[model samples]
Target: MFPGTEAQEETLMMELSRLVQEQVQGSSWWELRGKDCAILGLAFVALAPGFLLLRSSSLLLFSLGLLLLGVSHAAITVKGAHLSSHSSLTRSPLLNRIWAVFFIEVCGAFSADAGVQAHIKMHHAHTNVLGLGDSSTWKVPGLSRSLYLFIAPLAVPVITPLVALAQLKHQPLLSSLRTLLMVSLGLWSHFWILVHVSEFGSTLSALGCMFVTRNFFSLPYIHVNIFQHIGLSMFSPEQRPKRIYQMSHGVLNLPRNLLLDWTFGHSLISCHIEHHLFPKLSDNMCLKVKPIVSRFLALKSLPYQQDSYLSRLRLFFDQYQELMVLAPPITELVGIQ
Candidate 1:
């Protein structure tokens, strides 16, 4: 019902911007960089004991190793790649590009350029619009919820490289080759760690170790991606609400989890509405600015979507056919021009 005029929308954004500025006071971007650096080192820290415990004969120690490996992988892919994709970690564009290639292609096993094209250019730009950022894009109607929610996620680690390679056909040959080399390097390094460092009994056993470790957190990974965006309002391009209205209505924030908060960052977790509203701000800044954003939205009588993680999970489980397997109905919406 808001966005009665273009002036109204602009006024909302201007005041919202001032509120965020007051909260941040130009909070240090370098602090974001340092956090990313620490996140990168999470791999080494986890891998040290992870592989050691994995190589031991004890089943409990091996399970612990599996968990650590999954944590490191999530830290790198979810947080590391996500931050670099947004160019949130550094002021230097060149260094940002370097980090993208390192975290996205090397550590995350995905193409950096493709990631930017998809996540930034399309997803962020057109959230909830049909054929653009619709949460339904992830649907696999062929697979039942049991397979998708439980079994299929285990294949994500295996499928990510293939998907990245398929996206490279549109890219320049040099760029594609770089993506290929980096993805291969990532796969091989994981394999090597299990084969050499863990000294698995056989090649198949080593691959099994890699698969389990890589996918240790995959269930939550897929769950988190869907929980925030799916079941929200969907709009057509022509009828999309104003930017503020669109984002506030379209995004949902889930409560924090220790592993998810650290690995996915506070942005993708508890502070998601703020993240979508100000993607340029790092998680630290997002947290800092949340109170301002929340109060402003409340005062403006605007939507600030928040729901529990389990509640969403239950809803999706109960209504998977409507929300995930089928294209959602576009909300009948009109906003300021």
Candidate 2:
């Protein structure tokens, strides 16, 4: 239960929890595991062809292959790395940690441990808190809007690995070394495949391909990261309310989108309120209980923020200076005191 929630809101929370539990009870463990594994397997399958096609002499085929690989890489990062970091992909903590290291650190080219600290421990724990989880991952203060939108996103793939390396300074020596080794091996293995298996004429060309493919969808990725939270209310640490209230007011769900939904999962895209309410629930489970949660919130007269992606884009462009350039002000909810 959230601290300081009123009796009526508490009751609504209890009812919502019951409905979610009932929905989850009908799901099978195998089905959950199967879906996650299938997605990861598909990502690998997508990347495999890129290696094969890279060997072709045709530049068009090479570019097409790189695009496919890039999209698959982004999908794995979103659906696999993000879920595993939250321990929502599996019930076992060990398995979740393993997946995080593999998917986030290795394939996604970022630190798994840092992701847990930043995303799960910080972001989820303090959603929309000023200086905290207001989806500040892609912030580029003082940059021109055009450059911020176009050039900055393309740098994410390069910046990710560097950020991982920087994070090592704050970690224990042995653990840091281990992560360093794994990250190096992961990056080297991919490059080796490009050179040997893909038969890229030169290492420079292979490196260029890596940069292009890994960051192909970066613009949308960054947009989605900011779209859900930036324009919403931001609260100070002391002013933070109960989970349901904070999330409903702060998180905005985008309309149904095939690419965003498939890559980012239902919670980040469509069923955000349900997700913020039940952080432990899997993405599939979030989608399942979305209707129940939505109805319950509607009945309780709570905010269930939803917006179209295009509309958000327009709002962002119109208010870029106020929303992105400057820090957002804290929102004081009426009757909260």
Candidate 3:
């Protein structure tokens, strides 16, 4: 349904399918397992030091430790919860569901079911479709551009749990109760650890530490969420094209930075096109198959969208009026006959 002929579209789809098949055939399960374990280990490593230093008398040390903890939280949400929600963390469905409940619902402080519904079922299925897949972060109707850009993003950490709680009402009764229990237990466990193990001495300080650490990376997290799918073409359900065409036009990959790549995983900051093409592929596998996908797109003369992080930031700043302050108009492209 893109601008290409039916035969051309079929050829591209076939090539993409072949690339995915080849990648899957060559991949080792052990390698994926190891990578997942290592990243999960790193999340704990980032948090442990913060717990130990939470009661530090020195302000600077406490702030540094909190920053580390925040980075760990960000990494878990972006890398662990996101992947688990997609059922791409491992090959086992049971393990993926368990992982999603643990990382996404408990630690990430969001409902796993809601995440799967909104992210996988909706966002992935209908990328950049107006009122469907456009997960715009700055939708505050009367807010000024400067405040929307600066202040709104800082509220994400607080907003996450609240939104999760609200979304639970729409889920099935069993799932709603499970998410509620997990969130309650997760919050209580963190508080207990902070007060007793971390020796924070008082509940207020413990809560403060939790808040600071969890929200430290909120700005960047929100930025990355918006930058990828927003500021691009948006389609209606009827106007939407095939998967390959929709993703290539709607998604933009930010240039890879070592820190972001490690925290957010390769699928998000880089190799995003490959991830969109193969949503169920693990982040590491997406990186591995990036060259093949890129080359294939190039050969077919299809768009492979990529932009620098700074450039994207600048675009958001410069075009805040057009892109964020006002709702982006639905993109209408001619469908092939």
Highest lDDT scorer: 1
| Runs of candidate 1 exceeding 4 Å displacement | 29-33, 335-337
When superposed on Cα atoms, how far off is each prediction in RMSD? 1.7, 2.3, 2.0
Q: Lowest-scoring 10 consecutive residues by lDDT in candidate 3?
A: 30-39
Tens digit per residue, CA lDDT, model 2, 164-202 = 999999999987987888788878988888888888779
lDDT value for model 3 = 0.80
What TM-score does structure 3 among the candidates reach? 0.93
Ranking by lDDT: 1, 2, 3
Q: Estimate, for each residue in 260-322, the C-alpha lDDT of model 1 and write its tens digit.
A: 888888888988899898997777777778888989999988888888878988998999998
lDDT of 3 by residue, 1-337 (tens): 3477667777788978897788789778855556755886788887888777766889898777777787788788778887888788777899999999999878978899888888898888888887788885347767776777678777776788899899988999999999999988888888999988789878888887777777776777778878888898888766767677888888988887887887788888888788888888877888888888888888877789999878888898898888876778877657642
Off by over 4 Å in 3: 30-33
TM-score (C-alpha) between model 1 and the true structure: 0.95
The TM-score values for the models, in the order shown, are 0.95, 0.94, 0.93
C-alpha lDDT (0 to 100) for residue 51 of candidate 3: 79
